[model samples]
Target chain A: MIDVLYFAWLRERIGAPKEAVESQAATVADLVEELKSHSEAHALAFSDMTSVRVAVDQELTDMSAPIKGAREVAFFPPMTGG
Target chain B: MGVRVQSAPFDMGAEVQAFTKAATGAGAIVTFSGVVRDEGGTLASMEIEHYPGMTEKALEAIRQDAMARWSLTDALVIHRFGPLKPGEQIMMVATASRHRADAFQAAEFLMDYLKSRAPFWKKERGADGASWVAAKDADEDALKRW
Candidate 1:
């Protein structure tokens, strides 16, 4: 099981902060594609890839980054942290 | 290194002191603090929201990135959430290095990344009521220059 986290407006759009999902994704992009098919909310939240950012195992990474054996994956809007 | 995502206000002097005290063989410390602004007199208050776990993780990644890119010994980042008043400190970054240039550049880079990449949302409460602040093209452009 991989823990998926959402933040900022993504959380608002998805209506949850986090969830656990079982996946066979080999890469971050694969996981995103899986998520896009889960439900309408996921589709809407991820419709615009340009507005979203992904992190795998707590590290910011590109969508092509591998996610096999990963423990966590997070999606959110472009950071406005500092 | 220190990373905090909290709703409480932070003291700049105390945070800087902590960073310096935690560092060894550090000669220069650069600190940057972002404050809430009224922004054209339309905003009355601001509500900052963030993904709790992912927020900290993203910041740690940014800190690590800065460390790898610069000859820095230590770094600190603190970001606040929830409702905030104008002039309040919203976020801060401090980097320590042997030379001034690395500290300064790394701190700026960290800020740029945080602004353009981190996942925090801001809602401006004004005379017109509250609304989500739209992501600006300038912010995306700023990140591209890096």
Candidate 2:
């Protein structure tokens, strides 16, 4: 099981801040694919890849990055902080 | 070096004074503060959300990079999260160096990284409704210059 977190608009759309998922996905992309099937909200929140950003184990990474031992995964929109 | 992420407000004047005092040999100090703009009375409030553990890590890494890329004596970054009223301070970055150029350049570099690379998301509440502040293409492009 790994902690999956959503932030900002993604959290609003998904209706939760975080969750635990049991999966055997090899990479972040595969995990995303698995998550997309979880529910309608998940599907809608993740439908467009360009609007979503992902981080594995708290560091920014791309979808192709492996998630073999990642303890946490976060999905959110591009940051607008300053 | 210091990187702080909190919901509480910080004293900008005191922070600059303290940071300057701490850097004994620094001949130049540059400080930049980002305030929540009212956007011409359209904005009611701004809410900032961030990844807890990751926010600090990302900020520390950015500060480290700035220190490495510039001749700096010290650096500091403080960012606030949670709901804030218009005109409130959102974040601040300060850099100390032996010369003005390094201090100015490092401060700008830190701001650029914090704007996009940091894990904080901003939501603006205005007369119409609340909306997530979208990332600007210019922000991403700005990083290319460094």
Candidate 3:
């Protein structure tokens, strides 16, 4: 099982800030696809992949990045800091 | 020495003063502050959200990179998350170096990295409604200069 996190509108749309799920998915893309199937809210939040970015284990990475044993995975829109 | 992520507002004057005193041998200091903007004149406030753990980590890495690249005496970053009014300071970056060139360049570099790399997200609330701020291509492109 791995922890999944959401932020900003993604959190609002998903109606959750974090959760856990057991999945055999290899890449972040695969995990996201599996998550979308879990709920319409998930599907809506992830409907457009371009609108979201993924980070595995607190490091920014592409969707194809592996998540075999990551402790945490986060999804959110691009940052607007500084 | 590194980054600080907090919801409480900070005093830019006091922060810069403290950093200057502690920089020791630094010949120059540069500081920058980002404030919430209300471009349309209707923005009531902004809500900033960030990953609790990753926010500190990512910002620290950026701070380390800047200090190493410029041989700075010290570097600091403070970012606030939560609701803030227009014109209120949202964040600050400070750098001290032996030379003005190094301090200025490092400060700008830190800002560029923080804009796109950090885990913080901003949503603008206005009279009409609230909307998430979109990341600009220019921000990502700014990194290429380094």
Candidate 4:
């Protein structure tokens, strides 16, 4: 099982900030595809991959990055910090 | 060696003073504070959301990067997450070095990275309603300079 987290509008759209799911997905993109199938809300939040950024194991990474053993995955819009 | 992510308001004056004192041998100290901006009175407030565990790690990594790239004695980054009013301080970054140029450049580099690389999101509340602040392409371009 891996922890999936959402932030900002994605959090509101997904309705939950975090969740645990067991999946055989190997990459972040694959995991996203699996998540999108769960519900309409997840589908809406992740409809456009470009609008979202992903971090695997607390480090910013591309969706194409492998997530074989990552314990945590976070999805959010591009940061507007500082 | 100071990195803090908290929701409470901080006194910038005191923070600068404390950072400078801790810096010890630094001849130059540069501190920058970002304030919530309400354009033309349209914004009522801004809410900042962040990933709790990752925020401190990101800031500490950036601080370490700055220290490695420059001849600095110390660095500090304090970012607040929560609702804030216009003109209220949102965050601050302070850098100390033996020379002004190093301090200035490191501070700017830290700011540039923080704008796009950090895990903070901003939502603006205005007359129309509340909306998440869109990420600017300019911010991403700014990181390319470093």
Off by over 4 Å in 4: none
Decoy 2 TM-score against native: 0.99
Candidate 1, TM-score vs. the true structure? 0.78
Question: Model 4: per-residue lDDT, tens digit, B38-98?
Answer: 7989999999999998988888999999999999999999999999999999999999998
Q: Any residue pairs clashing in model 4, and if so which?
A: none
Give the winner by TM-score.
2
Query: In model 1 chain B, which range of ten residues has the least summed lDDT?
Result: B137-146
Off by over 4 Å in 1: A22-26, B18-27, B71-73, B140-146
The sequence of per-residue lDDT tens digits that candidate 3 reaches over residues A1-82 is: 9999999889999999999999899999999999999999999999999989999999999999999989899999888897
- Candidate 4 chain B lowest-lDDT run of ten: B16-25
Model 4 scores a C-alpha lDDT of: 0.94
lDDT of 1 at B24: 93
lDDT of 1 by residue, B1-146 (tens): 66899999999999888789998999999999999997888789999888666678778888899899999999999999999998999999999999999999999888888886666888889998877777778877876755
* Docking quality band of candidate 2, CAPRI definitions: high
Worst 10 residues of 3 chain A by lDDT: A73-82
Q: Which portions of model 3 miss their true places by more than 4 Å?
A: none
